[model samples]
Target: MKKIWAPWRMEYILHVDDSVKCIFCEKKQYVLKETQHAMVMLNLFPYNPGHLMVAPKRHVANLEDLTDEELKEIMALTQKSVKVLKEIANPDGFNIGINIGRVAGAGFEGHIHIHVVPRWNGDTNFMPIIGETKVIPEGIEKTFKKLKPYFE
Candidate 1:
């Protein structure tokens, strides 16, 4: 028998066991930057080397649900993570966003958070055009090193 490999769809299948919730919540409970779910941890797969996601502790699906303090913390942490990403990946650009609902492309539709993704020149190519696939060029742990300091 033979098996098929799908690098992108793997996201639907592979993930940290306890990481389905807000990552920031996990960090608040444990060490600051220790494990895979640390504040600066990388995407289970990443679009670029320093791409990072910073979320809050409590799970609030709606962006409007965030308190003033949570908003402040989110901004501050995002600033920190961006700084680290610049140092580590030195990307040519960035795309930061929050996907509020399923239509907005939030994989975890019940959890709300922001995505800070570093972009390089021509990261996408014929694969996306011809094959309808995305190629994430960096490893998760490597992204962690680049963006970890912002959390600490």
Candidate 2:
């Protein structure tokens, strides 16, 4: 049996009480870019190396709740996230999406956000299939540092 050490996941595991507060509403230390209406930040538990989330500053669960300005900024930031990931990670492709509710896989169900996941050729390996574990190749802090400068 091979062990994959992901120390950062411990923070998420210990602090995953949703009743504490909405994650998007909290002071995000890993924010890559922030505008008046929206911000882009690294996903604490990413699906891939450069996984990011774009969300409106205002807490709104539904898409209909977003103001036109907020919607625009969120989309713009999403595009910027893709560009930055392309330059830094050089991914073969991307998976950008929004999960509306718990059933749709929205971990933070009350706050609407867009997920921008960078995908590479051969990124899907046997570990996830057989071992039931996904491997993240880089540390979150390292990825954050690499991405922050581009957003600035």
Candidate 3:
């Protein structure tokens, strides 16, 4: 069994700052895609290199709260996100999902978001199973820069 050393997460885990800002509501410097109802942004703690999240603009705790327009926009943005990742990374596949509540593995259960993770061949390794860590090759800021222009 090999142990994956991810020292970078220590900063996020150790530093606890009290802010009322919701992860999805915070105005980001870089936005990958945005429609009237939804927007896409790079995931700060991603499961893969080209990981991104599609979220509704309005604050909603669950998918059921989204209107038909918001739902359609989010899905459309998700598809566009896939296209961008394909053009940029040419990933072998993708994993798109939404975790509803805390019990469903949502880090921010108060806001609804869909995760789009680009997966390459042999992307899955023992690190996740043994060390419970995900190894993402690129940083979120770098990925944000790479994807931001595509949205415009």
Best by TM-score: 2
lDDT of candidate 1 over 64-138, digit per residue (tens): 887777777777767776777677668788889987876556666666777888877877667855686876665
Task: Report how far off residue 92 is in candidate 3 (Å).
Answer: 0.9
TM-score of each: 0.71, 0.88, 0.82
| Residue pairs with backbone atoms closer than 3 Å in model 1 (clashes) | 25-57
- What's the ranking of the predictions by TM-score, best on top? 2, 3, 1
> Which residue pairs of candidate 2 clash?
none
RMSD of each: 7.3, 5.3, 4.2
Quote the lDDT for 38 in model 1. 21
lDDT score for residue 8 of model 1: 62
Q: lDDT values of the candidates? A: 0.62, 0.87, 0.80
Cα displacement (angstroms), candidate 1, residue 55, comes to 0.8
lDDT of 3: 0.80
Residue 143 deviation, candidate 1, in Å? 2.5
Question: Considering TM-score, which of the candidate structures 1 and 2 is the better prediction for this target?
Answer: 2
**Ranking 2 against 3 by lDDT, winner:** 2
